[model samples]
Target: MTLRTIVVDDSIIFRKVMRDALSAIPGVEVVDIARDGSSAVDKIVAAKPDLVTLDIEMPGLNGLEVLEELDLRGIQTNVIVVSAHTSRGAEVTTQALSMGALDFILKPDNDNAGANLAQLKSELARLLKMVKAQPQLSMVSSSPAKSETLSAPIVARAPVRTTKTTSVPRPVECNLENLKTPKFPHLCHAIFIGISTGGPKALASVIPKLPATFTIPIVIVQHMPPLFTATMAKSLDNTSALNVVEATHGMPLAGGGVYIAPGGKQLGVKADARGNVIAVVTDDPPIKSCKPSVDYMMSSVPSSIARNSLAVIMTGMGDDGRDGVSYLRQNGCTVWAQSAESCTVYGMPRQIIENGLADFAFDLDDLPNLLSQLAYRAGGYCPVPPIPSTTAPMMATN
Candidate 1:
């Protein structure tokens, strides 16, 4: 299927360059080009392109203004921002994400514009794949005889728990005997969780059940954009017993609180001169096509949490957490993954479970109870039963 696209930039040369690059992509066709944001908005409405590449610094109407116009008109076209690498540009790009831009690409320096143009082609191809994957493009009609409905709402649900607590709760007694514990003994000082796809819902189910007295600091990397992440964090904070907020650079990961990696920035934990672990947000290149990537967070755990870390990989697309899980396992940290049956997308967890990287695999429904048990254990939590020799096969669910 061919994806119709529009390129919007004030620079005549840059607009042509983007048009030529996009036109070269296999399944993408440049349907229109606009010299500025005003023209872009008009052409977008008339052409109704499947995707839009917007320049951040356009005159008359900036990229953000164009997005606001689209929002006002209820146009849900996929948009990618082309921005400079200046601090102001980075801030603008981040703000654009908060305003619902899909993603942003750094503009190449003037001296290396040619080389950068080559790189932009590959990036545009990646963006095209992401655009095709969006739910909005599913409405596009290929045949002239077929009618398309572009007015439907994109069904996006905030992550929330589906179950209610019963008056009579069954309690499972703790049995320390006959349990095979690790020889070196894993201690979790910080808990790192990587989730995507149905993460908000999964987090809502698990986080609210955690005790306010739970001491270990928690850090989460949920695949999402800025506004979505902000909304999710607020939702979690309101529902869960613990305090939750979008993570900021240099902030200390405090006990009994949850820190969510803000969207559009790579979040990593690093130790300071005083040996205190602090959150670091950077405009570093994306890992596995995500800024607030799971791999980035998981890779930083060994150094931050040292041998006393716990890592969990939940439902998500791709193998972002596989290597990070492996690293944690090798460093004597406990790593857990969601069972396939409980996942919206079984990609990340499947990789770890199949590769023997995960120490325990549990269904989503069982996670809250298991975590409660661990939290109640003496000298921190531990999984009751050891991992089976073979992994349980996982399946995708809505």
Candidate 2:
């Protein structure tokens, strides 16, 4: 099946380049192109393609305005916002995601376009394949994730026949109450997480559910560019009970706060002279083609804060968190993975689950309660239920 797509950008050069780049993909086809927001919307309504590459700074009406129009008119379209790497661009991209754009790509500035566009092409193709294979990620209404505890059974789609990456397959749904959680040497001192793709919406969904009395320090590695992470942290801070801030070098880890690893930099942990663990922000080379890599953050914890860690791997594009999770497991740290149905991409956690590295697996909406039970001790009623080895995995009816 051809991955039908449209490019909506005002720049003639970018329009041509993006069209050519997408056309070069084996299963993708550029269905149409629009130079302005109004025309983009009109053509989108007409073509109704599988995906749209929208520019945030288009003339007549901005990209966000076009999304507003689409929402008002009830036109169902999957949007991928192509935005600049500036602070303003990050702010708008956040708004776009909240407004229902599935994700955004960082368009390089004029000086680095030649080198960076190649990377952009690869990312665009990867996302297109992801969106095509998973219809759940391309929701036309509401945010990607909802801020609710696990109440409804997951509605699965026709099983996507993927090339089996491992011999031992994970059951579709394991009963968490019956599954044995990993034992730790001490109470979970901090929460370390890695997420991508649908994370902005996921964070918004999960953070509000965390109570103010919860005191576990949370550190997140969300794959993004320099200023984007800061903007995302600020957005989450406004609605959350805990204080959320962008991570800075030398900042000591503290309870009752959330720290986002600054984008375009690798964030690691280290012990200070007084033996207190602190954030180490650096411009180290990208791991698995990603700065702020999950592996980078997870690896840092094993030495400084391993035994008291509660590591989580969530939605993302690749196995970036695998090695780090392995490290956490080897060091006696507890780890949890988000269930596949609740994930936008299901790559990171899928790798850990398939490898039998995760201690517990929970749905995305159930994140807050899981955190409460483990970190806050607020859900003590369900704390560490007896594991039932004879139980069968529950299947999700499509």
In the order shown, what is each candidate's alpha-carbon RMSD? 13.7, 10.8
User: What is the TM-score (0 to 1) of candidate 2?
Assistant: 0.78
lDDT of 1 by residue, 1-398 (tens): 67888999989888888888887889788888998889899999988877789998888999889999999998867678897766566556656765666666766665777786788898788656645543433325332212111222222221111212112112234232312232222455677899875576678778988888776678999887665566667777888888999999889887777999988887877555454567877776666667687766766652335466778899766667665566666667777788766775566776666666666777888877766565555255322222233422111111
Candidate 2, residues 36-115, lDDT tens digits: the string is 99999898888877789999997799999999998998887788999888889999998787677878988766567666
* Number of clashes recorded per candidate: 3, 0
Worst 10 residues of 1 by lDDT: 158-167
Query: Best TM-score goes to which candidate?
Result: 2
Q: Tell me the lDDT of candidate 1.
A: 0.68
The per-residue C-alpha lDDT of model 2 at residue 212 equals 90
Which regions of candidate 1 deviate over 4 angstroms? 110-113, 133-189, 193-252, 256-293, 296-317, 326-398
Q: Go through the candidates in order and give each one's C-alpha lDDT.
A: 0.68, 0.74
TM-score each candidate.
0.55, 0.78
Q: List the pairs of residues colliding in candidate 1.
A: 159-200, 159-201, 340-394
